[model samples]
Target: MPRPLPDDLLKLPHRRDVPFAKLTTLGVGGTCRWLFEPTTEGEVQSFVRACVREGLPYKVLGGGSNLVVLDDIEIPVLRLALPKEVIREGTRLSAPASYGHIRLSQDAAKAGLAGLEFAAGIPGTTGGALRMNAGAYGRELVDVLQTFRFLTPEGELVEKRPEPGEFRYRWSFLTGGHVALGYTVALAEGDAEAIAATVAVNMEKRGTSQPLSKRNAGCIFKNPTGSSAGRLIDQAGLKGFRIGDAEVSPEHANFLVNHGHATAAEFAELMATVREKVRAVHGVELEPEVEIWR
Candidate 1:
C-alpha cells in the first residue's frame, strides 16, 4: 500500500493519473499517479524539503527521452518547469535544468560556440544530459562542462565544478535524492558557419543511422567494452525481431521501436530475449542504458 502524501506536497502545481505512454519516448507503460511540475527553483526546493520532512521517496523526471516506465508510479514525481533563459558570458553558456538539450546545442552553434556540436542531436533536457554525461562522436558533456548546480538530498543547494569520479560513461552522481538545477559549459569561439556545418553533419549522421521516425528510448543497451551493442545485436541476427508491437529496429539493432500500441510488458520481454540470445551466442552480458521506472 502507498503512504498518504504530505499536505505541503499537495499544494504544489501537479497533475494526476498522467499516462506514462504520453510521458516517455518509448510510448508505453502505465500511469504516473502524481506529477509535480515546479516552475521555479524555490518551488523545487520546497518540494524536495517537503518530501524529506515526510520521509517520502520521490523521483525526478527530465525530458523522458531515456526512460521506460513499467507500471503506475504512486509516488510523487518531480519535473522541472523553470524559465527557459540561457545565460551567455563570453564563451560560456548556462541554462536551467528544464531547458531542452537539442535547443541548447543549436543556441551554442548560433553563438559560434564550438564545443557543443556533438550534442546537437542528443535529445532530452540539459540536466538529463548532465545526469547521464551524454556524449556523441567521441565527445561528452563532461568535456565541456564547467560547473553545475544541484539540490542535495537534504534540500540544500550547491554549485561547483565537476570533480573526478563524479561522472562516468552514461552515469553521474546525481542519483538517489539529488536533483540537478542547471549547468554551465565552457565553449570556444569558432566560425558560426563552421559550427553549423559540424552540427549539420552530426544531425545528418543520426538521420541516416537512427530510426527517428519510430518511437524509441534511444539505444536499449550500452556498448560493451571493445564492441558496439548495435553491431553485436546485428551480428547475432536479431534485427527486425518483434514481440507484439515492440521490435528491434532493422535499421539499428540497438534501438527498440514501438509501432504504436506497444505494451510495457512486450518491450520488457523483447529486451530479455535480445539479451539472452546475444549472451548465448556472443558470451557478452549487455547492460541497459535507459533508466527503467516502475
Candidate 2:
C-alpha cells in the first residue's frame, strides 16, 4: 500500500475522490484520489519540495489533454491553477502554464502578432503544449518558443532558452519531475486581420477534419517517421471499428472517440486491435502519442 501524503502537502488547495472523467478530455477512467491545485509558483514549489522530502510519488496534470487514465490514481496529483496573466515585451509574449493554448493564439492575433495562428485549434493549456511540443500544419511550439521557466526534479526553478534535443516533434525533455511554470514565445508583428484570417482557416480545417462531436483524447497514435498514422489506420480499415463504446473515428482514423459510455478498458482494447490490424496489413508498428496512465 502507498503511504499517506504529508500534512504540509495536504494544506494546499485540493479535492478528494475526483473522477478522472471530469479531469480529462477523453472523459473516462477511475477517480483521482487527491487532486492538488496550486495557484502560484511558490505553492507549486512547496508541493514538490514536500513530496520530495517525504519520498512520496506524485503526478502533474495540465489541461488534461493528450492523456488517457487507465485506472484510479491514488497518488497526490498536482494541477497548477496559476493566474492567467500574459506579459508582453515588444514582439514576445509570455503566459503562465495554466493559460489556454488556443486562447493564447487568439490573444496573439489580437495583439497583431503572427506565428501562433497554428495553435488556434490546439486544445489544452500552455504547459501541456510545451510538454508535447504540440504542433499543427507543419508548425510547432518550439519554432516560436523563446525561453521557458520550469522547476527541476529537486524543486529548483530555472529559466533558459531551449537547446537542441530538448524539444522535438511531439516530445520534449520536460519529463520526469520537471514542471513548466510559464513560457515566452517570439512572434513577428503582423496585420491583425491577416493573422485572424489565418487562424480562422486553421480552425475551420480542424473543425471539418476532426470529429468535433465526440469525446476523445486527441490523436491516439503518433505518425511514424514519414507516414501518417491516420492514413495507415484508415487504409487498414479500422475506421468506425468499435469495441463497446470506443470506436476508431470514422471522420479521422487517428482519433478514437468515446460514444457516451465508453470505458478505459474498451478504448485500450480498441487501440490494441487497431495497432495489430494495422501492423498485419502494413507491416508497420504503430506507437501511441497520447500518454496513458495505467
Candidate 3:
C-alpha cells in the first residue's frame, strides 16, 4: 500500500518540470513531473527517506548518459549530484560515485594510483559506471572496487563488499532498489607516466571508434556471446541507417545518434527497426544497454 505524499514535499521547487532531453546525452525525451538534485550524500539520504515515508515512487538519476525516457509519460525523477571529494587512505580511495570518471582517473593519476586509467574514457559518473559494471579494454569496475555504500528502499544505509563472481560483463546484483552513495577503490602503485600514457591511448582509441561528438548513448545493445554488437550491426548494413533525425552512427555501427531536433518517438522507432532487421537477418536477439523510462 502506498501512503499519501506530504503537500510540502510536492511543493519543493526541486519538484518541477524537468526536460529529459537536457538531462540525457541523446537529447530526446519529454518533461518529467518532478526533479530533485541533492548535492550531498546526507541530502540524498534525506530525500530517499522522505520518498519512502510518503510511499512515493521515485527513480534515481545519475549522469543520464545511457537512458531513454519516453516522451509520452510523466514520472518523478530524483537526481543525486553529490560533491566530489576523494580521500586517500593508503592504497584505498573513498569518493562519491557522482564524481565523473575522468575526474576520478585524473585524481588517481596525480596520486600515482593505477588500475582506474581504463575508466578515464568512460563519460559517466562512478555510480552509473558501477551500475553497469562499465568496462573497456578488458578492465572493469569490479577490478578496483573494495566496497560500496548504498541506500536501501527503506532508506537504510548499507555497506557491501561484492565478490568477484557477483559481477558479469555489464551487470551486477546491485541494480534494483539500491542507490549507490559512494565507493572505496583499491589501487596499486605504478609508474605515473606509464599509467597516464595508457589512459591517453585508450581515450584516443575511443574517440576514433565511438561517436563522442554526437548526441547518442554509448552503445545501444550489449555484445552477444563470442561476437561484438558493433560488428554484427555493421554486417547487417545498419551503419548510417537513418529514420527521421535518428540514425545508426556512420562512425560506429552500434550507436544510434540524434543528428538534430530528434524526438524520443523517432529514436524509439529507429531502435525498433534496427532490432527487427538485425534479428531477422542474423537470428540473434539484441538486448539494449540503455535504460528506457516511460
Candidate 4:
C-alpha cells in the first residue's frame, strides 16, 4: 500500500485517475493516479514540503508539450494552477512557472519587450522551458533568464541567477526533486508593433515548417552537432513513415505526429524505427528531445 499524504496535500484541489491523454499534448497515455493542482505559491510550497517530510516522490507536470507518457503513473503528480499573472519591473518581467510559454512571449511583446521573441513559437509552460533550457531561432531561455525560484530536494526554496555549466543546449541542472516555482526574464525595450511583428513572423515560420495541424509532442529528436535533426531524417528518406497511427511528419521529419487514435506504444515503436533508419542511412545517432514518462 502507498503511504498516506498529509492533510495539507490532500486538501489541495485534485482529482483521481486523470488521463494523461487529456493532460498531455500527445493526447495518449494511461491515467495519472493522483493529480494535484496547487493554485498558489504557498500551496505549492506546502505540497513540496509535505512530499519531503513523508518521504514521497512526486512528478511536476507543466504544459505537457514535450512529454511522452508510456504507462499509467501510480505516483502523485503536481501540475501548478497558479493564477496567470505577469509582473513587470522596468526591463525585468516575472511570471509564475505555470504561465503559458507562448503567451508569455505575447505578453512581453504587448509590453514592448524584445528579448523574448525567440519564445514566440515555443510550446509548454515557463517552468518546463527553464528546466530544459528550451530555445529556438538562435536564442534560449538562459540568454534572457535573470533569476528563478525552485524548491530543493529537501523542500527548501532557493533563488539564484544562471550559474556556470548549469544550462546547456536543450538541457539544465533542474532534474531530480527540484521544482521550479517562478522565474524572471530580463528583456529589452522595443517598439511594441515591431515586437508583435517579429512574433508573427516566428509563428508563421513554425506553421509553415512544422506539422501544426496534427498532434505532436514538439521535436522528437535533438539536433546533432552542426546539422539539423529534421534535415538528417529527411535526407535519410524516413519522412511520411508510419507505424500504426504514429507517423514521421511529412512537413518536418524530426517531428512524429499522431493522426488520431494512436497509442503511446505505437509512437514509441515509430520513434525507434526512425532512429534505426537514420542511423543506418546517415551514420548518426539521434537523441530524443522529448521527455519519456514511464
Best by lDDT: 1
Task: Residues 1-294, candidate 4: write the lDDT tens digits.
Answer: 766777888998889999998998888888999999999888888888888888888999999999999899888899999999999999899999999999999889999999999998888999999999999988999999999999887778899999989999988888887889889999999999999898889889998999998988999898899999999999988899998899999999988998998898998899889889889999999999999988
- Please list the C-alpha lDDT of all candidates, in the order they appear: 0.94, 0.93, 0.82, 0.90
lDDT, candidate 3, 166-233, per-residue tens: 78888876665678888999999988999889988998998898888889888989888888888888
Please write out the lDDT profile of model 1 over residues 23-46, one tens digit for every residue: 888899899999999999999999
* 1 versus 2: better lDDT goes to: 1
lDDT, candidate 2, at 267: 85
Ten contiguous residues minimizing lDDT sum, candidate 2: 1-10
* lDDT, model 2, position 233: 98
Candidate 1 residue spans exceeding 4 A from truth: none
The residue-by-residue lDDT of candidate 2 on 189-222, one tens digit each, is: 9999999999889889989999989999899899
Candidate 3 runs further than 4 Å off: 1-5, 8-15
Residue 46 CA displacement from its true place in model 2, Å: 0.5
